[model samples]
Target: MAMEGESWPRVRAVLAEIFDRDAEDILPETLIMGDLGGESVDLLEIAVRLNADFGIPVDEDAAFLKSLRYLLAESREKGIEPEAALRAAYPHLSAERCATLAREAARPQAAPLLCAADIAAYAAAARK
Candidate 1:
């Protein structure tokens, strides 16, 4: 289920343009915000560009992991484990990654683990 082929290049190009970084430096594993110095505004631009470039609707919340805190809160309210909630919300991420994200979500100052591959996966799924 890994995102590959066409979507990576297109997503990388979009990230490069938005972050003003070379496309070659924008690896699939590169953290969008942590590594590229991306901000909330950049994420908005990324979502907009992905929709326009691929002709696919990009759910900005899902793509950018914007609802991590909300999902965690909801899970707690519903008596569900944070990891389970994270996995349910982001099935494209590995269970291990989801667990890590769940732990990180507890720390308000922690940057999300979202990466270029995550965005590319969203684009690939949207294409289908």
Candidate 2:
């Protein structure tokens, strides 16, 4: 399994290609839906590409993915803050990232609801 840093470029490349942008523009903090104009279909494509490129499933079946899905579901269900839910579910994520995820998740129009850091985190967690 490649380290998260090692997978960063590959993940960025995939996101760049999916969004028809330059890899340099896909910074770790770049938001998939908010900054990059990504849609649900783009997320599916990104997941497929990430799975192919990293040899790790980025689907609901993956533990990290499942956890995130559950977190989102629980957040929506229980009226808990998304950030709080993410903090509880993904302790592997940095405190900063949990804040970012919570902010994105709280947005009404955010689709994909991911940033480059999320991809790197998923890749790193999947490797473990």
Candidate 3:
């Protein structure tokens, strides 16, 4: 909810990255499935990433996670609760887990610290 102007661009970039496409050409009016040729799995990835980054309640179930900007905008405009629809669409990330995560994310970071070893470990782990 606190996302500023940079958030939209971030979301768009994440979506494009998930689809292995160019981010520059992506726009709010772009038809995800039609113009981008993303499939169900692709959508699931996008939903998970969006849910993680945006902290929005995504109903995991529903016919499918289709329509990019239109559905989100409509839900926002109509004050529709998307968590239910998202639950209907894909129930993997349960409401309880979502709530718990939101609470945890709201908490401040424990410390501002980093280590070269940690970065090296992360890089090494990613290669595994």
Candidate 4:
């Protein structure tokens, strides 16, 4: 397994290639969907590329947080706070970021909050 630091540059390169943007523009905090205008198909391509580049299988849903909105809704239905649920579902994210994402998820038409760091974290974890 590569260290997180080592995985970041590869992930950044993959994202830049997929999004047709400069690698310098794909910062850790850059939103994949919101900032890069990524769609669900792009997420699938990212998973495929990461899987090949890292020589590890990348679960699309886990890597890209594909089920985040569903998780949020399920949590609310089960009387769990969305922030806590988000943290449980995505431990790669800081609790504070999870809280912020929870609020974003609650908006009627919020863009997904998945970021470049989240994908890199997932790839690094998969390498383990």
Per TM-score, the best of the predicted structures is 4
Candidate 1: global Cα-lDDT? 0.86
Give residue 92's lDDT in candidate 3 (0 to 100).
Answer: 37
lDDT of 3 by residue, 1-128 (tens): 22224455666677678767787776644555656776668657765765666655444332133332234445557886544433433343346433433343334652111111211222222223
Off by over 4 Å in 4: 1-4
Which candidate would rank higher by lDDT, 2 or 4? Answer: 4
Clashing pairs in 1: none
Q: Residue 38's C-alpha lDDT in candidate 4?
A: 91
How much does candidate 4 score in TM-score? Answer: 0.86
What are the runs in model 3 whose C-alpha is more than 4 Å off? Answer: 1-4, 60-128
Model 1 agreement with the true structure over 1-128: per-residue lDDT tens digits: 24566988999999999998899898988998789988889999998999899999878888788898889999999999999998888876678778878897798687777889888877887888
What range of 10 consecutive residues in model 3 has the weakest lDDT sum? 110-119
Q: Which stretches of candidate 2 lie over 4 Å from their true place?
A: 1-4, 60-84, 103-113
Assess candidate 3 and give its lDDT: 0.45
lDDT of each: 0.86, 0.70, 0.45, 0.85
RMSD of 3: 15.6
